[model samples]
Target: MDFALVGLIASLILLMVLALKGMDLLIAAPICALVVALSNGLPIFATQEQGDIANYSDSYLGGFSQFLKVWFLVFLTGALYGKLMEYSGGAKSIAHWIIEHVGMKRAVTAVVLATGILTYGGVSAFIAAFAVYPLAASLFKQADLPHRFIPAALALGSVTFTMTSAGSMEIQNWLPAPYLGTTPYAAWQVSLFTALAMAAIGIYWLNRMIHTAYQQGERFILPQASIIASVEAEQQQNVNPLTAVLSLLAVFITAFLFHQDYSNNALVIALVAGCVVLVVGYWRQLSQHFTKVGSEGALGALIAGANTSAVVGFGSVVKATPAFAFAVDAVTAIPGSPLVSAAIAVTVIAGITGSASGGQTIALPILGPIYLDAGANPEHLHRTISLSSGVLDSLPHNGYVVTLIRAICGESHQSAYLALAKMTMVVPGICTVLALYFLA
Candidate 1:
């Protein structure tokens, strides 16, 4: 391997290590980007004397700015939209409804199903986690299942099949459409099978793990008093389940109807419409909490957008290096269907970046033309990249996984990550391979 490539790989590893340590990406990303710049002989900053040289400002910040330019609105509206569903009791309403219908006898199944529904329905995965968790805790306690598996159940629902499925409200599903000139429903036939296989296999594995824990005499542990109190408070605000479902439908139906001409703009419109529905549904309560909701939502959007862009900046710096060109050549030269090469390239970048959107945003710009020029089906590439992005992007460093395990569930990685890995990484990985075979 070339020395620059070695440096690139080492920088990525360092970034992952920093992520696992729970350092803020806003800080970690730039530090690692500097490493890539220095090691690759890129300039630290472009000056008047060296106006055209790739540097941290031109490369890293340029990448970062471009991501925000393109995606800030999506993140902004997505966060506010999720917050509306959350604050107006829409998400909780749906969670309660699912739990009521599914019954507590199958606690693990209920959590997974509820989370999947909320996520697929256009609620942010973070919001869905918060909404369902109170219900999930109560269910697990009542059903006598161990609490450690809650993160896994959430991951299985939020990130695996639901996140990558055709027409999913997830950004991952939408990211490839613009790049490949395909819709989110690209290759619907293969995506349908991939999603079903992922869900069926994941549900089975989650249940089997719970059963084993039961056989070992494991039982649910009580959560903190504050956690219990929050659940009770959440139960107090009971928005109608129908209202909740409508809010979700607004996003999905509008996006589906408009995605062809508007592309990702459809998502922005859909999210705004969803927010409007929730605001109307909960107008009375909005008087009390409207400002707080907007502020919090915007803040959340800022954080999420900045975090993704930081990683994208790192990708930007890496992209300027000769090593990146070399790596791309090697990946594209792989002797197989262009779909196979696309999958490998997308998955590898997603894994390295610890972000699906960040990875696809970086790789697709370069790889999309290559595969399309080679006569690969744009729809196939869209589906392949979408599914592949979900695969290794869930390593322990992934922001969503880290948040779910530690921030939401209050469980350490050592206790919860094994189950999460199985759901997010292993199951999706198997389904991705199956997708490649079918698409091939």
Candidate 2:
């Protein structure tokens, strides 16, 4: 038995377990990195090797630093954008406007569309969930829709179609660019079709599930009276819906105009533009909370950036191990289209890691070189891996799923997760398969 391989596998398992147990990734990731280092016989500090030093700190921090170097701005701006939208009453205004226009008859659709718009505009999904939840709850309550389905509607809008689709400002869509030398608009033709498919099928399935639950006599259950009052209080903010729409459009327009010229950096510019729009557009509404919101947004960005960086650090350690090399060899050796192999490898690793970004961070460094050398289309490969990453990464144990269902929505997985799974996992998985068939 290869003890080193065993340690790698063990570390991966522990990472997932710790994450699912609500442990901070900052602590869990480093501990797991130490495990892989010890098992693989790496030096804890530094060692002289062929006129250079080989050390665990270098490898671990190297990956962490590299990710931050490349993505810190994006993360910072994205969080601030989300925060401005939230604190300025812009996000709520948008939600209320959509609900009003769509009407109570299609309350779920309104909530989902609201979330989709925010997420596609580059707001963090977590922030989008929190910002939209109050509106979603009120809508469901008014429509007599089951409250348990709230997470599903939010997750569907935030993660499935808009998140992975071409031209999205999400990091998942942008992460592959530097590695593949492709723009965020990679394979956009196929992405448009796949996104439409996911939207149509996922929305239909989600509505069907809600309708089924309603038919079975399930209806919205009011939360504790205190919780209701808190939610209602949160939803009482007033802001002009038109200004909010323009704030969102500022992000979309800036990104659209600059993406071709600036690539991923366009997102930073776009988010900044959006923030300025919100601040100016809703100055009176946000004046009291401006300082607080900016500080909170910065703090949120730090936490999110650190979490992703920690996992990337773990991947850095994994990359230096013999086990990772062997695994890479095995994956690349699979007999089939390189796109198919890339998709399978990325999706499986994403499922295991419980993070699409983490999985792609680990796999792309190895697969990018191999596939590009094998004459694969860089644009197609980018789209394939991005779409595939979203599929299995939404497993029950995933951090995002847990946060959305339990932490944010205050609902148990037993009731909410079925709808969540259909919209996120199943829908994305089907789209990934179809993407391979059509793009390959």
Q: Pick by lDDT: which candidate is best?
A: 1
Best by TM-score: 1
Q: For candidate 2, write residues 24-55 as lDDT tens digits.
A: 88888889988998898877787555334555
Angstrom error at residue 19, model 1: 1.5
Worst 10 residues of 1 by lDDT: 223-232
lDDT of 1 by residue, 38-104 (tens): 8888889888988798887788899999999998999999999888887777888888888888998
- In order, what lDDT does every prediction score? 0.88, 0.85
The C-alpha stretches of model 1 lying farther than 4 A from their native spots are 223-237
Candidate 1 lDDT score relative to the true structure: 0.88
TM-score of 1: 0.96
